[model samples]
Target: MADLTGSDLTAAKAQDDVAAPPSAPRRGGAAGLVRWDTAVGALLAVLLLCSFGFVGDFGNTLNLSFLIGNTLPMAVIALPMTMLVAAGEIDLSVGSVAGLSGAVMGSLWNAGMAIETIIPLCLLLGLVCGLVNGLLVTRLGLPSLAVTIGTMAAYRGIAQIVLGANSVTDFPQQYLDFGSGRIPGTFLPYAAIPWAVLAVIAVLVLHATGVGRSLFAVGASAEAAWFAGIRVKRLRLSMFAATGVVSALTGVFWVLHYASARYDNATGLELSVIAAVLLGGVDFDGGKGTLGGAIGGVFLLGTLENTMSLVDVSAQSQTVVTGVLLVVSVLGPRAGRQLARTVARRRSAGSGSAPAATG
Candidate 1:
């Protein structure tokens, strides 16, 4: 084993790569998922109960439907985003990808194309957008954070060029209903059905299958995962593509839900998705987090925001709250990881000083 000196977990990881790499975060990996997951889940439940009891109009079927409907787009994109983040990467341009999808949808609609024809093309466009980001990161070895930031701007710019300032609101009524309308005699939105189905698939992929385990391995230690034959690059690339498709799908839903398609549709939504996901206890550092936690975070924030709105809290204040939550999520995981590393190190030192068993 290599003698490790660094106190920083990432620095230690960087230093101890070759000679018996230390599993720096194996014991409580993924940012102390069990603790944070349970914490966030309980918090969400409390928020819902309190909101129902205290907030007027929040428990009503109409408001509940609106809340779920509005949240589905962010939640949909979050499914793939969680996988991507857990695999040690992120696409900050998801909101932009969604915007581009909406822009393209509007442009094609203006060109008298069939809505059915336009939807597939929009999805394909998102795929291409994601592939471009993937290729840039995988092939060029660029950081995903930086790459997505650049692409976020570029994608939004292209969306603006494609749709300008125009708002397309003439989409078919049925599609709009599917986007925002509640199910008959229930509060569930029609769009939630697809999101639920996708959520189940994501849960299976992230928690139940080998690929899910691979995602954690890759995020935990890309080099180790690669050495262990995880096909790291391909897995990350596919996750990005999946994120793109979902973002595009969210864009379509955004347009339909709001009864408008503009270049700026879903603008700044990446912040909300990421905030909700991290708040749900998915470690921002990768290799740690649960899909269920991410979903809980989504609803918690969603319900909080909706309740705030019903009570006339300003949008600016809401944004501030979101920003603050994002900061907390990032910090909470880092603090837990630091503590975990310290405990693991002490345990290792203790074991090293222990007497060997006599044969």
Candidate 2:
């Protein structure tokens, strides 16, 4: 056998590293799809049972429709938010973007443009807003958190200025029904159909495709992904833009659902989105979450809210509950990961010392 040189060993190690799959939680191919996120989803099911068992009228078709309908917008935004977080970025400006898009939509509709025209324009404006955030982050090399915070305020301020304490509530009834209406004989809202399609797409993109795998790489370590030939900056920019577009679309849906358009629409929604995403097991720091978990987080919060309202729990207490969940979501995974590493280190030490004793 030929002797292996140090350079050959180094090259072999590098190759092995390159060939290794991403260390993020897997959803397919022998991973069996059960994970921490699955546990959260199961919790959602438990909450539903409790609601049915205890809360009066909680299982009624009308209330269920309203509950799911109200949550549709947040659920829609959560899809793109998952991808962005997985790619190691965040868009705090989404709520503001949604508000601004709604404001623009109302203004244009009130100015006598066709709703069709107004909708497309509003979507384009959302793309522009997202692109601006992307440019500032990727081109200026700014931190996404700081950049998005600034844009969040800017977008909301612009929305306020554009609509200025006025609301447009004269939308057509057909459109309104589409936003908030339920399917015949069922609690499932019409909005759910679109959200379902989007969810499936998000799952495929995040779990079944090369782009999804690349996002895991980028989130785990951008520098390493870049060295491995991924276009980290471009990928992140695309994520921000997609977030903007989806958020704006949700804004349109919100106006229709409520049959009201106000600059303050979707106010404080970013917190809920973040809380649900993180609570579902997507790490706030990026690179370790699943779409299933994120979706479950959204439903868990929704179910909790429904149950509280049914049992006459005050909104103030509900807010506290949300805050606690948010805190726990971030801390829980981190604590678990730390404990896991500690156990692993101990096992390694024990194995090595056993060999020493045998020698």
Cα lDDT listed for each candidate: 0.87, 0.86
Query: Could you estimate the TM-score for every candidate?
Result: 0.87, 0.90
RMSD of 2: 5.4
- Model 2, position 181, has a per-residue lDDT of 88
What candidate 1 gets wrong by more than 4 Å, as runs, is 1-34, 339-359
Per-residue lDDT value at 53 in model 2:
85
For model 1, which pairs clash?
Answer: 30-288
On residues 1-359, what C-alpha lDDT tens digit does candidate 1 reach at each position?
13232234434343334212245444455555457877888888898898899998999999999899888888998899889889989899999999999999998998999999999999999999999999999999999999999999999999999999898999988888888788899999888888889999999999999999999999999999999999999998999999999999999999999999999999889989999999988877799889998998898889889988988999899989999998988897787668767666666554433322210
Q: How many clashes show up per model?
A: 1, 0
lDDT of 2 by residue, 1-359 (tens): 13434544454445434433332223122222347788798889989988888887998999999899988888999999998888889999999999999999999888999998889899999999999999999999999999999999999999999999999999878888898888998999999999999999999999999899999999999999999999999998898899999999999999999888999999999999999999888977778889999999999998898789888999999999999999988876666555554444444444445444443
**In candidate 1, how many Å is residue 18 off?**
21
lDDT of 1 at 92: 96
Task: Judge candidate 2 against the unseen true structure and give its global Cα lDDT, from 0 to 1.
Answer: 0.86
